[model samples]
Target: MEKSVAPDNNNLAHSYNHIGGVYMNIREYSKALSSHEKALKFYEKNLPPNHPDLTTCYNNIGSVFYSMGQYSKARSSYEKALEILETANPSNHNDLATCYNNIGAMYYHTGNYSEALLFYEKALKMIEKFLPPNHNNLAHSYNNIGGVYMNMREYSKALLFHEKALNIYENTLPANHPDLATCYNNIGSMCYSMGEYSKALSFCEKALEIREKTLPPNHPSSASPVVPQNTNKNNTYLLAASWTIAVTVAALVFMPKFRELNCTSAYEGGMKAVIWTDVLQALVMLVGLLSAIIQGLIVLGGFGPTFSIASKGGRIQFDNISIDPRVRHTVWSLLIGSTFNGLSIYGFNQTQIQRYMCVRTTRGAAQALFINAVGSAFIILSSCLIGIIIYAYYADCDPYTAKFISAIDQIFPYFVMEVFSNIPGLPGVFLACIFSGSLSTISSGLNSLAAVIIEDVYKGLMRGQLSDERQGFISKIFSIILGAVVMLLTYVVSHLEPILNAATSLFGALQGPIMGVFFLGFFFPRANHRGCLVGFVSGVALPLWMLVGSQITKNQRKSERLPLFTTNCALPINETITFSSPVRSDPLLDLYSVSYLWYSPIAVSTVLLVGLIVSYLTRPLKPHAVDPKLIIPIDDVFCCYLPKSVRHWLRCGVDHENYLNERVCTEFIE
Candidate 1:
């Protein structure tokens, strides 16, 4: 029956070899050895002693023995395989290189470094001759030799080989590939051995960063179980602090040069260059976001299925009209609270105000604002769609619940890596998009901050004057100083979970009062300086106190989150997962549980109410005494359809006719 089915002995032997491989993969070493020995018996009976089939059989047997930790038997089998390969074809071949690497691994495992080095070099030479320069096989050979050198205490040689492997890996592998992390770790060990502590730390950090990106948070490899005995714990802290300071100082010294080379053209070329750069960055951000959304939709088989899955999972919701402040994303909070926040940002923020000043006319600035509003809306909608897509993809297998990531914020990046890892350059484009947005924001913020400090404080308040060159120098210095301050603040904010809320809450706390002051000066002619001062102080204090108190009490409140499931998680049979119930707090702690969205509205309303009360009580400015140019003509701008009586009431005592006459006289004078 066997002969009728297959006359060829080689074919029957190949079946046994495949069975052996399967058993080997499942770690059933005894069964794998039995299968490989049966294959060997067949190959010996029909094939020549030095046939490639016999050589492969020997290699399979050797692999099983290696798995069984019988090094002597493994080495003998490997030697037989190599001898057969050498006798069959003496010329260099990939099979010969692989055999050499396997034998080298055996020797290395047995602590025979010299023999390992000899065989590893032989494999490396053969690989270099036959394979392309950046082939992964060549990297494997280099890494094998590097390991031998490291065990031999030859730090320099180990470093050179490890770096060669790392170069190939960086060029050929994905950014967060495990092989790259291994190479980094090897190089770091070599550096540590050579007493190059800083370089060691840098490479170690690189390895850790890659591991953090790729591995589960609870992975054994992610833990630091042991530290080097010679290493000082305090030195690590000191080195980290020193490194941060060094980077900041280097940035201070070199950032001006970098900005001059890359960004000065935009600033010096005026609004056109700046606008074009912003447009390009916006395009990049949109393209990246769209790519992610498109990829996610495709994975989910289209928008229909994606939304269906998300809706089923209870991720799609829009009718949350509850007025409860403790509710995180109610319609009332989003609309009313976000309106005040938007006003603080777009209406009165210094960075935005600087952009407004760049326009030659109010009409041009208004056009810019409209365009910005449309673009912002599009981006926001795209982000929400992305959130839904991510939810749908991970509906069954939630990464956070599976411990794939340590924080909720890491989910997006984790999603990108999981989905786009197979497509080269897409991850890089996403990263570039993130950095582009960050750089634009930071640069604009620093520039505006420098301008405010120099113009409002140095010149206006201190009465300081300097030449253009001196002023330019001082502005750069101030930008560097502000940049450093921002970096420190970033470090502090990094510890806060759900950083988006923390950041927006902080922004509202600080900027709400500033926006209120702007509102008082622009529309309320009766608002006195004393009223503005007191109102600004009150607005800042209230929101800031709330934000800080909420942060302090955050642990006591239940985190508002979408449902997560680990029912489909690929956990071991013996492993058990237990989820703790949400923390319960006293009713008195509810004050700190207010939605972060409400902070801006609360601050703005407080300012408006306080400012108006103080103005009336502490001698308000008379309508005639107030300058027409100082107050915006609210009635003239928006109340043209209303009756004269209604328009007068809407003006808050600012005389529109006087403002119109004054504007006409000014235009005539000009």
Candidate 2:
């Protein structure tokens, strides 16, 4: 029997459409439309009109329309794509997920937030089975969900979803890589919004530093434009932003220069000194920022601490290795679970991945990771001191803190705001830091996000290969659009109050479901897609519901604390409420609660067992979908490759504990 030949046109169209999608991401709808139309024409020539690739074209076109804010056209395009895809791929094919995802994105753009979520859920169901636990595409869905929550004033949910994406970024990508920067910026922005200015400053500065090192001199990546290229759209905009940042820095720096130009005032004197001093800081910062992306390493000292130390109520100190999974930072959980988390953060995130991919050996990558851990420790320690500084400053406490301006999270921003508000030149220094953080994140995300869409989602699914030049072109287009979106969102971010809590909860909530799905897939080979879908759905829904309930409970608690003078009373704050006692051991006690520490492992366990059962029951995908190596028992040969931390566990007769699939490792790496 002659072998059935796969159509080559599918490959060509797929490449074009995929690249086109990247352009659409940057808000270059016209370019995207052209690419999709070409893809559609090829689909018509090579395959039937009802072929799934055709649906992609329609879907993309509609997405462009939606991006352009043409709701009617966008909906029509989605409907056409849906009709075609359903006919060609049906419920089971992976193509359906993208189609569904496209619809969800449109609904979101059109302000049909609830409807957008509906389609996102549908698309996610399909992907939970096929993609890796650390897949970036899956992260996008999580991000989309988070964005919805953000729109709904569910700051917690928004942060959760964004963090879900960031968690994957942390595991899979490098610290200085552009994508990782996005995660950092995102997390930082949330912290900033939540009034954790110190944390926000730290995170943002880190992100900005990374971007400065990674992107070409003129790239515009600090924003999220749907169709932005990884590179600059025009040298004009890139030059403009650079000049603006430079002028801002100089203007702030030259407050003293102006005085030498003979500028006046105590403020001007302070500003000039501040500007010159700040200029020195910016130049020094350039070294850290520039070196970061190229080297996959960054070393940031604390933003010098003041004498103030704010009291943090909820904190965790060392504890015994208890059997209880709920225990915070048990010896086993931190050692075991954190290793997995670390692996994912390094192995899968684009930031981390892109960094090491350029290196000569795994040893180099490992060294970078070591540096990262060390750097992280320093940052945390410095933050603790900074927190103390805050405690000292606010110990007496001022009741009238503005959520937008002077919240705890706004420390970094507040500091910057203060520079301009009181001392003149200081604003220039902080502004550089802000740009360093935001731009780096936007640039990194734009680059990595584009790579994934083009490579994994497109190349993995489509049959053809792209030339390197074409790949470069595609990546360039995506970078711009993704950057613009980030910028737009930044503008929108000011609107979100109660930012830190929302960001944290949002991230934590996403972690459970996403981590669960992947854990189920990677650790359990027997799990079919049907089980995957069920587990994934459950993972998302359970966390979402839990998050909602938690929010409601919080609101209820607030309502109970109403002041004495309300005629038609709204909810009240519960002044009667008291949290756990302070830990004075180190006299510096602040960490995530125990419940959150175990959330990842708990969610993973839930998804795996639940997915296993679901797979056993549903049997969605063929056995081929579950790589045999993952399900089968492993041997001593694998021990050589294992990280030293886990090597002993395998020897101690616990190889059964989430065995790594050798095949899985190669799939993620270059």
Task: Give me the candidate number with maximum TM-score.
Answer: 1
TM-score computed on alpha carbons, candidate 2? 0.42
Note the Cα lDDT for every prediction shown: 0.76, 0.54
Q: Encode model 1's per-residue lDDT on 522-551: one tens digit a residue.
A: 878899989999999999999888887788
In model 1, which range of ten residues has the least summed lDDT?
571-580
Q: What is the lDDT of residue 65 in candidate 2?
A: 62
Per-model TM-score versus the true fold: 0.60, 0.42
Each prediction's Cα RMSD?
19.6, 29.4
Error of 1 at 569 (Å): 1.3
Local error of candidate 1 at residue 74 (angstroms): 54
Write the residue-wise lDDT of candidate 2 on 450-544 in tens digits: 77788778678767878977776666666666767867876655544356445444454555566666666554556677787777776666545
